[model samples]
Target chain A: MDSIIEVSGITKVYQKRKTKEKIQAVDNISFQVKRGEIIGLLGPNGAGKTTTIKMICGLLKPDSGQILINGVDNEKHRLRALTHISAVLEGSRNLYWRLTVRENLEYFAGNRGVSRKNVASRVEDLLQKFRLKDKETELVNRLSRGMQQKLAIAVAMLADTEVILLDEPTLGLDIETGYEVREILKAIAKEENRTVIISSHDMDVIQDICERTIIINQGKVVTDDRIEDLLKLFEVRSYTITLGEHLNEKQEHLIKERFLDYQYESNRIQPKLSVELLKTEDIYQLFDILKLNETPVEAIDREIIQFEQVFMKIVKGETTNGVDQVKSQSV
Target chain B: MEWIKSNLNLFKANFRKETIELRRYLPNTIAMLLTVYIIFMAMFAGIHSVGAPGTVDATIQNTIVNYIFWYLTITIVNGQGYEILTEATRGTFEQLGMSPSGIWRILSARLLAQGILTAAMMIVLLYLSMLTTGQSLNVDFVTIIPIFLLTCISMFGLSFIIAGLTVIVKQIQAFLQIFQFVLAALTFVSLSRAPFLVFFPITKGVDMIRAVMVEGLTLNELGFSNFLVLTTNALVYFIIGLATYLYCERYAMKKGLLAHY
Candidate 1:
């Protein structure tokens, strides 16, 4: 697929206002988002996801490197480059509070370069498509958060830009509303060929919608892979072992030292052991620890890993193999 | 032609938006207009109570010009900065920046819309003050147009400086308030009395307008050389203000201050 957005070695550093200490917000990050692809940007708070998204949308300039949209360098030709892009930045509801839904749509459509004659029809189309037709005459501030978010996205779409960047689209939304928004994004992705980059903390959003996911932690890209591949890789190592007896001190110490995120439940009558190994062959190491005390292993079953668990592992820096798997897949 | 066409579209969109906002906040607009009216009446009453009857007409005439000039200066100066601050506060600054019209075009359109509305309001107030004070004066657009145009351009230039500085120095209202007092003082400086003060961007134009309004002086009567001096001050200040704004904007983007309120 041809790349629609290329972010090359972008780095952003900020100095603390009081102490004047330099903080690396994004460190030499590079990625290419292909045309019509829905890429999820996953990261914990303060992980530089917002910084990266801002740079891509031309809201912030990187100290080093470039962002190109369809071969136009954003830094060199900002307005021209941004012509191909639209973004709903985190915390930027991006609607005039005083403007009604229809007015907001019309204003943004005109402001984003739609001709005066086309603005009304385009806004009407979006209003109907986004299911905001009922609330078209309502002020944006008066709408529910879900409706506001849908309007923000609808306003972004009014530009008809090739790439749309949504930062935390589902943040601060209720379960039903979040699901509705997720459905809206899903529909947008399926219905349009535009490239969509969503930066979200919700694992379900990444799992259900994105074709590819870029996980960032501490100003670095920790894992970049398809959500399926990550889930597959992490699921194989997760094992729940029914131990014949409670783990002895040496066995517990050995397991703790080997597995960083293992849970050993001493349930007295029926002790349980759960561990996620780095490798499939590493089961021998677990057997060795159990064999030391002649501890019987009643049954060992592979635990099903969710996208959230896989994400936690990657962000917690518990799995280098996950990054390696993703790196190899990208190649 | 394409550049003109695109900018015109932007201006139209922004003008419409502001108009909608003005209508939406109609009560606020009326309140602001009422406040201006009350202040004008208070100043008139105060002047009438304290001043000599013989000089009352002259004082009233001079006061109208001075108050208009001061009001225009502060509104343009404070208003330009306030627009930027409000955008930042609302978290809409980035969206405005990201628009294909660009920040400069957007700000230009917004300011132009505001300028039109303000000019109309000022004209209304000018007539109201004259009628209420029981004074009749010559209302010549020919004399007022040139001076108004010159002052607007000069003040716009100064406003650009204020707006640019606002991007870096978020707490700029205090600075603007101080500048308002300085402008209040500058509005009284007569070009005929102190010709060297023509070096000031707005004083020359204010003095020229006061001359035209009070003394009924024509462009030729004011002398073409004096007109040149007035235009020169406006042009010079506008160029400096534009340069300062462009520099500050570039600096703000580099420092990531564009996202800061």
Candidate 2:
């Protein structure tokens, strides 16, 4: 796919007003967004997501690096480069609170160089698409958070720009509204074939909507890969085995050495061993431990690991390979 | 032609938005009118009680022009500054930056719309102040137009400087207040008595405006030399103000202050 947005070695540093200490907000980060790709920009709080977004949107100048939008350098030709992109920033910052929904749309459309005659029809179309037709006359402040977010996105879409940048699109929204927004974004990305770069704390948003994700930590990209590959790589399957009798000391020691997170329950009526295996083949090692005590395996059940857990594990610096030493010791 | 059309459309759109906001916030407009009225009434009462009814009318007219001059200066300075401050606070600065219109076009459109509104409001208040004082001052807008345009150009320059400063300096209100007082003193200074003060922004232009209103000096009657001096003040300050504003904008963007309130 042709790249619509190319961000190369972009860095930004901010100075604390009082202490005069320089803080690197974005440290030599680089990524290319292909056309029509919905890529999730994931990070923890204060992880330079907003700073990166601002640089790409031309709101802030990068300390060093180049950002090209549709082959135009944003820093050199801001107005020309920015014409190809539209951003829906976090919160109500992008919206005019005092203006009605329809007014805001028309105003931004005009501001974005949309023709005078087409603004009305374009706003009408977005109003219907975002389900904001009923509240078109309502003031932006009067709309709920979810509706405001929808309107913000709708306003960005009004420009009909090729690339849309959204910072925390589903932040502070209810589950149902969040779900609705996710579906709306998915439909837009697929049907419109518009490139989208979304920064969100919600893992579900990344897992469900984005095909690929760039995870940042401490102002740096820690992992940039496909969501499916990440899930498969960090697939930690947990299994519980019911034993006829309690395990001896050697077996207990062996179980502790093999698994990173597991529970050995001996006092209950059914002695069960819950083991988290990083690799599927580790189940053989687990059965070996249980067989040492001649304990019969009555039943076994596996626990499902979710994308949220995978995200947590990755962010906490516990990559799937981090436990290979335990696996080596068992051998 | 296409570029000009797009910029004009942006200007018209911004004007419409400002008008809608003015209509929606009726109390703010009313309060602004009352504030001007009260200030004008105090000036009228002070001069009337001095027992100079003959000079009272002329004095009131002169004061009205001066008041309008001061109002335009302060409004342009603070209004443009606050527009940026408010956008930053509301987080719309990024959105504005992302638009194809650019900051220069956006600010120009907004400031032009605001200047027209302020000029209209000043005219209405001038009439109301005259009626309330039971005195009529010969006011000629045709004569005022040339002087008004020159003065407003200089004032717009000052406004650009203030807007730029507001971007770099987070707490600029205190500085703006102090600068307002300095501007008042310079603008009210007698150019004939202390001729050197005419170089300051809006100083000579306000004096010329007073001459047009109180003395009924036509643009031709004001003489080319005096007109030239006012023109120089307007052009020089305008260029200086624009340069300062552009410099401040570059620094602010480098420091990432555009996103900060």
Candidate 3:
């Protein structure tokens, strides 16, 4: 894959007005975006996702390091580099509130030097694709949040840039609109063959659309991996065991001692134990504890974990050394 | 050539947008029209009060000329420059800055649009004054046209200065109000005492216009020295405004205030 954007050792620090304390918004970070890749930038609030995206889009300059768009240094040849990228920042900042949707599209297209004759057809195609044809004549401010967001993306698309930077595209949309946006993004990534870097708190949107994910915490990247790999790695270790009989006090004590994070639910007729194992062999040790009480296990099933749970584990620093421990115990 | 093509498109689009915005604020337009009418009516009343019975034509011509100068200056300052300030306050300045077009071209186009509107207003007001006061229609088109053009160029320069101030101050409307107050006082000083204000550019322009319209002085009769001073002042103000805009652009970038609303 060809790298379309190369961001290396980028850092941004903002000075607090009252305290005059410097806050690091983006720490020394380096990442490369391949052509036609959909990458998700995930982080909690104040984790510098926005600052990082702004730096990449040339909206905000980094304190140190270089951002190369198509091998052109953004700071050195800003207009030239920016010509190949467009951004739909948070809260739909790219739009004109009073201009009608059609007018905004035409204006942006014209700004990009698209011929007057081509603007109409290009706008029509985008309006139809974004499902905003009916609202073409409506003022942007009058449109619903979902429509505004769609129009913003549509406008970015009209710029015909190779890379599209979307900051919280689904930040304030309803579930249906969010899903629609996700579908549109998927289509855009697949059909248009454009690089997309999305900074968002919506894990579902990230899970549904992005192939790779970069998780940031405290302005530093904690994990950058394929989404499926992270999900499978975290999912394989969780299990729920159905016990044939209730656990006695001694057996419960031993189980608690061995499996620190296990849960016992006594409400079910058979009773159930939910635990995550560092290794598949750890289940045998669990069996050893049940055997001490002569308690038989009826069945054991793997627990499917969502991306949100895997994210929580990674963010809490619980998964850093667990992968090694799991491998040793399983072998 | 490329710049012209791009600016032509930008100017057309911006002019259309401004027209839409102006139409939406119909009440303001109506208010402006009423204000212009009232000023003319008040001038007529004042002329009648001064025991000038048969000198209505001369008085009306004098009042119309003054009104043209005053109204055009006020409109350019408050109308076009105020809109630029509003755009700055709304964070649209960053949007414009990020565009490939230069700031000078964008602003110049806006001023050109304002000049056209001001010229149209002056013509309408001239006609209206003629109908109301029955002024002699013996107007010297050759003299009035050049005076009007020079006045507009000077006003454009002043508007640019005001726009630069608006960007630096951030609070556009308040800055404009204060600017207008100072301008009103300065105009009073210049008009009340001619010799004391002859050193000022605006006053000099007004004097030249009054000389030709009221005293019927030709370009040769007035000599080239006064024209040279007026032209120099306009050029100086325009250069100052451009320099101020460039300085403000740098300040905004360093302070990270371009995108701040």
Candidate 4:
């Protein structure tokens, strides 16, 4: 697929007002979001995710690098580039609190130079689709936070731009509302061939909706690949071993010493040792420890990993030394 | 035609927004209108109670014109700054910044809408003050509108300056409060008192309107030279204000201050 958004070597630095100390928010970050692709941008707090998103939205200028939206250079022609993009930047705050749901939608469309009459039907569709038709006449301030968020997304959707950037879309939503919002985003991506870039802390949302995930940590891209690929790579390294006999204290200590991330569950009906081995050959060392105890191995199975664990490892910079390095060696 | 239609759409959207807000904040709008009216009446009473009967009517007429222009200048000019501050606090400034119609155009449409409404309010105040002082000043919008519109251009220009500054500083309340007096000085001081004041923003337009309203001058009677100065002042101030605003906006974005709140 052709790329719709190209960000090349972007960096943002900020100076503390009082201390005058410079902080690097985004350091030489580069990525391409292909058309119709849902890419998740993940990072911990103060990791420059918002800064990078704002720069991509043309709301902030990077110290270096260029952003092209649909081949239009954002910095050189920010407004024109804006024509191809919209964002749900601040969630509920992206809307006019005093305006009704419908008014907010119409007003935003009008700002894009689309006449009110022209967008009336699309507004109705969004209202119905977002489950906000009943609240169309209600003031945004009076509505629930979830409804306000849905309205904010609806307003961005009303722009009908090629790319939609959502920063923490489900940040403060309740469980049901978050699920509803997730469903809405999924529906939008499935129906429209629009490129969606979502920055979220919800790993489930990322795993469920995004084909690719870009994990950023300390103003750098730690990992950029498909979610499934990362899962598969991590899964292959994790093993759950069932033993026919319980291990002695020495064997348990040695096993723990060998695999620092090992889990021993002798309290269960069956004795088991679960561990993730960075090197697949490390399993031989694990079996050697079992041999010393003369413990028979009942069954061995690969442990399935969760996206949240993958996100944690990637953000902690452990993936580079562990799974990512292993993948490079395999390649 | 495409340009016209696109711009008209922007204008209509913004105009409708302002109208809806006015309706929503009806009590606030009415209170502000009443405050201005009461203040004008108090000034009229002060002139009435004081001596100097010979020039009382003349001063009253001048005050009416000056107050109208001052009201228009302050509300529309300072309004831009207040609007930005509110938008920033509300977290909607970035959305407005992303508008393809351009933030400048949206603000221009907003100010124009406010100016029209203020003009309507000014007429009521003009007639009300005339009734209070029993000094029947001319109510000729035919002559006053051209002058009012020209003066509004300069006011809008100053508004742009404030809007730009607000984007950067984000706390322009103190500056805007001080600017109220600056605007007052510009609107109240006549060019005859200081001929150089003719070049100042809003001053020339206010003086010309006062001439037409108090001195019974018609559009043709005001002469083309008069228009040349007014139009030149409007355009010059407008260009300078817009340029300053655009520069500040780019600086704000570069510094990542677009939506700090």
Could you estimate the TM-score for every candidate? Answer: 0.91, 0.92, 0.84, 0.95
List the DockQ of the predictions in order.
0.55, 0.69, 0.26, 0.83
Give one digit per residue, the lDDT tens place, for model 1 in B31-52: 9988988987898899999999
Candidate 4, lDDT over the whole model = 0.88
On a 0 to 1 TM-score scale, where does candidate 2 land against the true structure? 0.92
lDDT, candidate 2, A1-331, per-residue tens = 8899988989998999899999988998888888888899888899899899888988889999999999999999988998899989865568999999988988887776555576777777888899999998999999999999999999888889999999999999999999999999988988899999999999888888898888777787777777887777676677888887888899999889878788988998889899887678899998887777778888999876787887677677775743431110100
lDDT of 1 by residue, A126-198 (tens): 8888889999999988999889998999988888899999999999999998998899899989998789999
Q: State the number of backbone clashes in model 1.
A: 0
Give candidate 1 regions above 4 Å deviation. A241-300, A320-331
Q: What is the C-alpha lDDT of each candidate?
A: 0.83, 0.82, 0.74, 0.88
The fraction of reference interface contacts (C-alpha pairs within 8 A across chains A and B) present in each candidate is: 0.49, 0.74, 0.07, 0.74
lDDT of 2 by residue, B110-219 (tens): 88888888889888887887777765665877767887888888888888888888878756767877888876776666688788887787888888777877777787
Candidate 1: give the clashing pairs. none
Instruction: Supply candidate 2's per-residue lDDT for B257.
Output: 86
Score candidate 3 by lDDT: 0.74
lDDT of residue A134 for candidate 2? 94
> Looking at candidate 1, what TM-score does chain B attain?
0.94
**CAPRI tier of model 2:** medium
**Order by TM-score, highest first:** 4, 2, 1, 3
Q: How high is each candidate's interface RMSD, in Å?
A: 1.4, 1.3, 2.9, 0.8
